[model samples]
Target: MNISISSDPQTIAENCADVIWAEDKTSRMLGITRDSVGPGTAAVSMIVGDEMVNGLDMAHGGLMFTLADVAFALACNTRNSIAVGNFCSVQFLRPASRGDRLTATAKESLLDGRNGIYDVTITDQSGRRIVEFRGHSKIVPGTHLAAASGDPAAAEV
Candidate 1:
């Protein structure tokens, strides 16, 4: 969270994306590209695929939820080291098919001391909202997975 740059969301997002995309295999597999990350917002997008579908040929709920979760994490940790997402609530409003492009956006709704709140939304290429989510995250003092390992810089984002 020690951002060296000014309060530019797009810039912060690009920098964070570079680090995250390079290290996270889950993000790579999901094709989750960072669209933007600012003071209180994070945006990411991906294309729907067969592997992500449910029995009805729609994208799986878990994938949708994961996408939103990533957005929330990104938004919550924009300028500081933070642990987030003790709980999340997701509601699917529509279904998405293969080849459809989806974007998930998370915006900070509240931040109080070590706790944070975010509102997330998932949409298709046509700008159709497919799902809505809200999450709560906690900002801890130190790194969780990265510092735990010998290399404190493992998760540089």
Candidate 2:
């Protein structure tokens, strides 16, 4: 809720989209799509696929973690506040099968200037939680420093 500039929600979402779109398998395999971003809420959805499953035929922990991370990113980056994950921990509760649609919802728990915390949940098509993640992100000013440099590989933070 602390953006330096006031703008339409769509503009904020679009700017975040550019970052997500550039992600590789972590985003693609999880089927991550930004739903919306409001003052302090961010939603993202994903679908489980064969490529996202482990040998046990359930969604891989990494896939769930990625989806949760995406939600955390969007939630903490509200108002054009670029955020980077300082630390994240994911707990796997259940498992999801292939073809199951997954959605990760993240909401800001607290924000203190440049530091924010988020709680994210990953659920299956049936709305059963498969994983829960707690992420700590740091907000900073300006556009994504990596994208601004034009070298995405060097932007890994």
Which number leads on TM-score?
A: 1
Backbone clashes under 3 angstroms, per model: 3, 0
Candidate 1 structure, TM-score to reference = 0.80
Task: Give the clashing pairs for model 1.
Answer: 1-79, 1-80, 85-137
Task: Determine which window of 10 residues in candidate 2 has minimal summed lDDT.
Answer: 1-10
Give the per-residue lDDT digits (tens) of candidate 1, residues 39-155. Answer: 778899999887999998989989989899888888887754545578889999989889989999999899888888899999999999999999999887763222224443444
lDDT (Cα) of model 1: 0.77
- In terms of lDDT, the poorest run of 10 residues in model 1 is 143-152
Q: In candidate 2, list every pair of residues with a backbone clash.
A: none
lDDT of 2 by residue, 42-88 (tens): 77887777688899998888777878888887777665556789998
What TM-score fits each model?
0.80, 0.76
| Regions of model 2 farther than 4 Å from truth | 1-26, 144-157
Top-lDDT candidate index: 1
